[model samples]
Target: MRQTRFHGRVEGAAACCSVPGCSEPGEFRAPVTPSSFDGPGSFRWLCLDHVRQFNSAYNFFAGMTPDEIEAAQSPTAGWERQTRAFASNGGDPMPSWGDFSDPLDAISARFRPTAKRQAVERFSGAERHALGVLGLKDDTDLHSVRRRYSDLVRRYHPDRNGGDRRHEKKLGQVIEAWQTLKIARAFA
Candidate 1:
């Protein structure tokens, strides 16, 4: 096959140029009408020389107002138009990372189970009961559980409570619950 010199030349084109009185092979495409919302409109085949002439005379802003022309020429023209938001998270509420000092903390918080979820989904029956005994929530971390245990011990212990034997039974129960929860898989 013979190759034409121009970049957009139609290979093996048999149609004659659309330009009147021109017998050259129609190797280039030119728009027959302005494009619209429907589509790119129609095209006319032209020879190299005639296509160059058509291009030279074509004015993209021919019927546009000065303001329209200015807007079209602006760097941020197309960007000003609002675009459809992507449904990336399957309709989940978007995290407000700007409100957080560390954006990763916001993301972590979003994925982390809530106290209710932990109680229902993660903790076993005994673990849940132990958590209740320690006066800690199912969502409480190991550190918080340890702190609560220490606080309860101080509050109920005979030595810490000024040798009061009245709370010894409550203190024993607290200690037993702490022992059970300390080695629990949920806390670990």
Candidate 2:
């Protein structure tokens, strides 16, 4: 039972061909030194016919500079300005906190007005038709429209319906619906 086809080789590697009378088995790697004072770069291996004669005389821009080999053969290689596209709502076009007083807090401020004053005097289409002619609603107030216009003027007062002058035209329409709810409470 023997099988052997070491493709890009390195299997259980204790490699050997650091090229001294090569006993073969080094499975290929290469650069043992170019410039690593003492850390990350070290590899020699080389046995597939001296790693194909050291990758046919490897010279990756060897001693660079013809404008560094035309800026390393740039098709925008390493893209000059680091290959654009970042602006998702660009930035720093200036406004980086020019006195960002917690969003212009104009000094210990307190602006409470997102619609109030009794919700703009309880919705006004003529104070909602004078709180529907005093049967009151729009959150009634002016002292509950003077207590529902004095209880509809004592229930259509004509001597309380005894001296009944036919409810005196319903007590002059409850005194003209309490003078249009006291002139719509001075404009609601």
Per-residue lDDT of candidate 1, residues 5-110 (tens digit): 7788887888899988999999899998879999999999999889999889998899999999999999898998899988776644544554344567667756
Q: Where is model 1 poorest over a 10-residue stretch in terms of lDDT?
A: 113-122
* Prediction-by-prediction clash tally: 0, 0
Question: Which residue pairs clash in candidate 1?
Answer: none
* Model 1 ranges off by over 4 Å: 1-4, 37-40, 84-130, 137-188
Winning model by TM-score: 1
lDDT digits (tens) for residues 1-188 of candidate 2: 75466467676567788888989778767877765666768778878788888889998998997898988897877755656677856422322232222444422222433242122233446556656766677656677788887887898787877877877776676677667667653434
lDDT at 145 for candidate 1? 84
CA-lDDT, candidates in order? 0.80, 0.65
